[model samples]
Target: MVRCSSLLVALCLVDTVTPWAPHAAQRWARHSARSANPQDVETARSADIVAVAESFGVDVNSRNKACCPFHDERTPSFTLNPDKGLYKCFGCGAGGDVIKLYRELANATFAEAVEALVKEDRPKTRRVAEVKEVDASERIQLKQANAVAQEVYAEALRHQTSGGARQYLRKRGINPKTAAAFGLGFARPGTARSLTKDMDKSAFVAAGVLYQDGRARFGSKVTFPIRDACGDTLGFGSRALKIRKDEAKYVNSPASAVFSKGSCLFGLDVAKDAIHATDEALLVEGYFDVLALHDAGCANAVGVLGVGVTPRQLETAARFSPSRRVVLALDADAAGDAAVRRLCDDVLPTLADESGVDVVVMRWPDGAKDAADFVAGRREQGETDAAIASAVRDLCAAATAWNDVDVCDIPINEADAASSSSSAPPDDPPPDDSQDELRKKIDELQKQLAELSAQVASS
Candidate 1:
C-alpha cells in the first residue's frame, strides 16, 4: 500500500511497471542484444526514478518534487520518492517507472533509451578487447573489485598481532572470533606502506576502498566493513586509533556505485536472519555497539550510521521484521533526545498505516553514554554472562512508547471537539443537568492534564 500525503506516495518500490508498447517482440529483441551489465539490467527493469529524472535535467528539491515534464507548469506536481525510487505527477497523471519517463522525455523507442543508458560512462582503454570487456560487464567488475578488497582487508586483520587495532579490540573486549566474523581490520599509518598497496589502483579507487587524499585516508584507524543486505562488501567505516584535535574521530568511505550513506544499517547482514526468526529488532547507534550487543547474545541487534534515523532506514527495517518491533537504543545524549522527538512528532504520525509497527524508545539511566559502554561496563563490574544478558533484556523490556499522545492530557483537535460538542437539535429544550455534567467532565480532564504535565516536568 502506498502512503499518500502532499502528493507523495511513501511506499512505492523501484521495481514497478513501465509503459510498454503492444508490439513488444521487436523491442524485446533489441533490448536483449544490448551489452548491459547485470545490475544495469536490473536497474532498468526496476529503475532508479531519481536517476531518470536527473537525466532529463529535473531538479528534485528537498521536498522531492520537480516541475512536470509532460506539461509545463510553474508549481511542481511531479514527486519522486527516494526511499522507494518511484515518481508520480499529480497534474498530468504521468506516473510510471524510470523507463517510461525516459521513453516519454527522449521521444525514443525503449531500445534506444536502454542502449544509451547501458553505454553511459564507458572508459577508453589501451587494449581493445579489455575495454570492450570492461564496458560489457562493469557491474560484475565492481563486485569483483569489492570482493578482492574485502579479502585483502580480512587477511590484514587476520594477521593483526603487531597492530594497534588488535590492542584496541582487546581493550574493548571484542574477541578475535567476533572480529573475524564482522571483518574488522587495521589500516597501517603510512601512505606508501598499506594493506591496499599491491592492489590495482583503479579497482580499489572505484570500489571506494582506497582514497587519493594526500595522506592514506584511513591511516592509523580501525576499519569496519559495511555490507549490503546480501552480505556483499560495499565500503568501510573508519575510526581513528590516534585521535588528534585536527581530525574527526570517525570517518567513512565516500559514496560509490555500491555504498550510500544512511541507506544501510551496520550488522544487518548478520542480524537479518535473527530478526526474521524473532520478528523484532534491537537498534543501536554505532558499529561497535552492534558488535558488542551481538557478542553479548543479542543476535537481533543492528546499528544505523548516523544520529537521526531516516524514513528510508525505517522502511528497510520494516522489510526484515514486518512486526516493526524496533527498539531504539541510541546514546543517552542531546542527539538521542532530538531523535526521539523527531520519531514521535514527525516519523510516527506518518507511519499510522504501517500495520502494528511500534517504535519503542529504550532509555538508559543518565550518565551511561551508549549501549557499547553499558555492555563493557557490565563486563568490568564482574557480572556473570547470564546477568549481563538479563540486564540487556531488561533495558529493552523497559522501553516506553514514544507516541503517547494522551487524550486526557491534551484535548482532541478543535475541529473534532467542536463537531462532537454540537447540540442535537435547536427545537428541543436544552438539558441544564447535562450541561453541568459536561462542564464537570472538562474540569476533571483539565485537572488530570495539569497533574500529568507536572509529573513529566519533574521527572
Candidate 2:
C-alpha cells in the first residue's frame, strides 16, 4: 500500500506533466492509444472501488465511506459506489469515476492511471547507494604499520637512552605511570631509518610513521598515539621537543586511509566510558590538557588537538555523551576565544537543530594558560589531587551555555591579540577612539536601514 507521505514525495520527485485538456474526446483518444484495449478500461471501470481506495491507503467503513482525502473533515463524506466503481467527496465536491479517482490520488495522467488500474507493471524510481573508494587491504596494512610503530615508539620512551625525552614529560607534570597509560612515547633522534628498516617502509610512510624518503615523521619528538574509539592506533600527533626555527611546535600524521585529523579526538578511546558515565564531555585544545585532566581524576576530558572542533568530532562525542553536552575548556587566550565564537556562531546552532546537543563555554581562571597549566599551578600551590579534581569539575559545572554567551564582548582587535600573553596580559580596554569608530559604523548602518525601509514603504 502506498503511504500518503511517500506518494506526495514521489509526485514531487517527478517533473510536472504538460497540461491536459478537459475535453472528453482528446482524453479518450490518448487513453485508447496508450492502453490499446477498450476491454481493459471496461474491466477497470467495473473493479471494486473500495479495494482501489484501500490500495492507496484509505480506510473505508462497512458503509463504503471514508473521510475526504481532498480536504480536511471530521465526518466521513467520501462515499464509494463499489458496484459502479465511483467515488464522490461531498465536502470538496470531488466526484469521479474509478480511473479519474486513481489519476487524482496518484497524481498521474488519464492514461497512466488507466494502466495502473489494469494491474500493469510500472517503472520505479532508481536509488543509488554510496560507495567508498578506500581499499580494505591498504587500510589493514596502514593499521598494522601504525601498531608496530606505536610499540617501537613506546619502548623508546621507556628506554634508558630516552632520559631527555622523559625529562620533557616530567616538566609537563606527566608522571611515568600516566604517560604509559595513554601509550605516550618518544622518537629518538637519528634512529628513524635504523629502527624501521626491517619493517615495510611503504606501509610506514602511508601511516605517517615515516616520510616518503624513509626518515621518521615524528623523530626527536614526544609522540602521542591517535587512536580510534576501539583503541586501534590510527596515527600519531607529536610535539617537537627541540623544534628548529622553521618547525611547527607540534606535528600530526597526514590524512591516510584510516586516519583523519579533523575527525579523531585525542584521548577519546580511554575517555568514552567516563564521558558516558558523566553524561558530559570536557573539550580541551591539546593532548597535554587531556592528560592533565585525566590525571586530576576528571577522566571525561578529550582534546580537539589544536584545531577547532569539527562536526564529525562533535557527533562522535555525542555518541558517548548521552546528554550530548560538550563543555569547552580550551586555552585561556584570544585563539581559544575565537574557537568558542566559531563554534557558537557557525557550528552549534545548526547542530542543535539537527541532533540536539548543548555546548557550554568554561572561562579559564585569570592566571591559567590552559588546562595543563591550570592543573600544574594548582599542584604547585599544594592543592590535593582530589581538591584540584573537584575544583575542575565545579568550574565545568558552572560553565555558561553557548546561547547565553555574548561573543561580541570579546574584541576582534588583531594587534591587541598578538601582544597579549596567555597568563599575564595588561588589563586595559581598547582605546576610546576605537569605540567611537564602531559607534559611527553602527550609526551609518542604521541610517542606511532607515532609508531602505522608507523606499520600500513608498514603493
Candidate 3:
C-alpha cells in the first residue's frame, strides 16, 4: 500500500477531480484528510517532503544548513528535518511543511503542488502507461469539444461574411488558405453560451472559452481558438471584431485544463514537419504573423502566442530538432522590442542552460511592425518572390554569426565585390617620414574616434 502522506501529495497533483481554486490550502488539507488512506499517510508524507527538498538540492539529513535559493549565499542557511518532514531557514526566517515549501520554492499553486508531488511518487515503469491513459482520455474529450467549437465558430464567421472579422483578416492580408490553415474563425458575440448549451459549461469554462456564473456568459467578442501541435484546440484567444479604439485589442483564455499559454506554441502543430525538415523555427509575436509567414511559403515558423516563452515550449521545440535554432521575429513596437530582449536575456539563457538550444534574433526591416506587416508591405510595393527570398536569405546569413561579430558593425560585403575590396583598404599611402610624428598623433585620434563610433553603434 502507498504511504498516506506521499499518496496525499501525489493524489493532490494527479487528480483534477476537485474544482477548488488552485491554491486553496485549507481545501487541500480537508481533501487529503478525508480521502487519504490511513496506512499510506505517513510514508507518503515523508516521501513528498524528501522529494521536494531533494529537487532543490537540499540535503535531507542536514538540520543546520541547506542551499538558500532566495539569496546569493554560498553557504547553506536552510535547515531540513527529515524526521518531521519540515524545513526552516535560519537566514530568511522561512519555515514550512512540504506543501508550503513547494508553494514558495516552485511558485506552484496548491493544486499544482499536489499534482507535482504525486507525479514524483509514480514508479518510472508505470509512468508512461499512466500518462498515456490520462492524456489519451483527456485528449479525446478536448478534441471533441474543440471540433464542436471550431465548427461553430467557422459557421459564425460565414454568417458574418461582411462583418469586422472578415474585414480585419483581409486588411491584414490573410488569404483564405492561410486563414483556414490556422483554423481562423469568428466567435459571434454571446454565441459561446449557445454553442456550449448542451455541453458541460464547466469544461468550456476550464478551457477559457466560456464564462460561468451558474450559467454561461459569452462576451461579445470574436474568438480565435489556440490549438496545439496535434491540432487539438486548447483555448480561445478573442479579439473585438468591431473597431473600438477604447477596447482591448485581444483577450486570451484564462488558465485552464486543456490550455496552458506557457506550454502551447501557436503554429507548431502545422509547422512542425517543416520546422523539423529545415532544422529551424521562426518565432513570432502573434498568431497572424505566423499565418503570414506560412502563407508566404516560409513554413518553418512558429510563435509563442504571447511574449513569454516557457520551459515546456522550449523542450517541445528541442524535441523536433536536437540543435534547436529559434529565430525571433517579434514586432517593432516597444512591447515587441522588450519581448525580444526578454527572449534573449531571460528565455534564451534558461532554454540554453536547460536544453542546449541555440537562439537567434531575426533582423526585421527597421520600420516593419511584424512578419504580417513585412509580407503585406512587400506585397503592396510589388516586391517579387525573389526579393522576399533574398531578404530572408540575408536575415539568415546575418543570424549565423551575430554573436561573434561586434554587434555594432554587421559586416555586409557585396557578394560580387572583389576579395581585396572586402579587406581593409589597400595600405594607406605611407605618411611622409618628416611629418610621421604629427601624422601618428592624428592617426591615433582617428582610431579613437572610430572605436567610439563602434561602441555607440553597438549600444
lDDT of 2: 0.75
The lDDT per prediction is 0.64, 0.75, 0.60
List TM-score per model, in order. 0.58, 0.62, 0.57
Best by lDDT: 2
Q: How does residue 116 of candidate 2 score in lDDT? A: 73
Best by TM-score: 2
Model 1 worst lDDT window (10 residues): 1-10
User: Residue 342 deviation, candidate 2, in Å?
Assistant: 1.1
**C-alpha root-mean-square deviation, candidate 1:** 19.4
Please give, for residues 28-138, the per-residue lDDT of candidate 3 as tens digits. 444454343333433345555666777755554545456654332346777776668777665533555675576556654444444555556422231232322223355
List the candidate 1 regions with Cα displacement exceeding 4 Å. 1-139, 189-199, 213-215, 352-356, 405-459
Clash counts for the predictions, in order = 0, 0, 12
Clashing pairs in 2: none
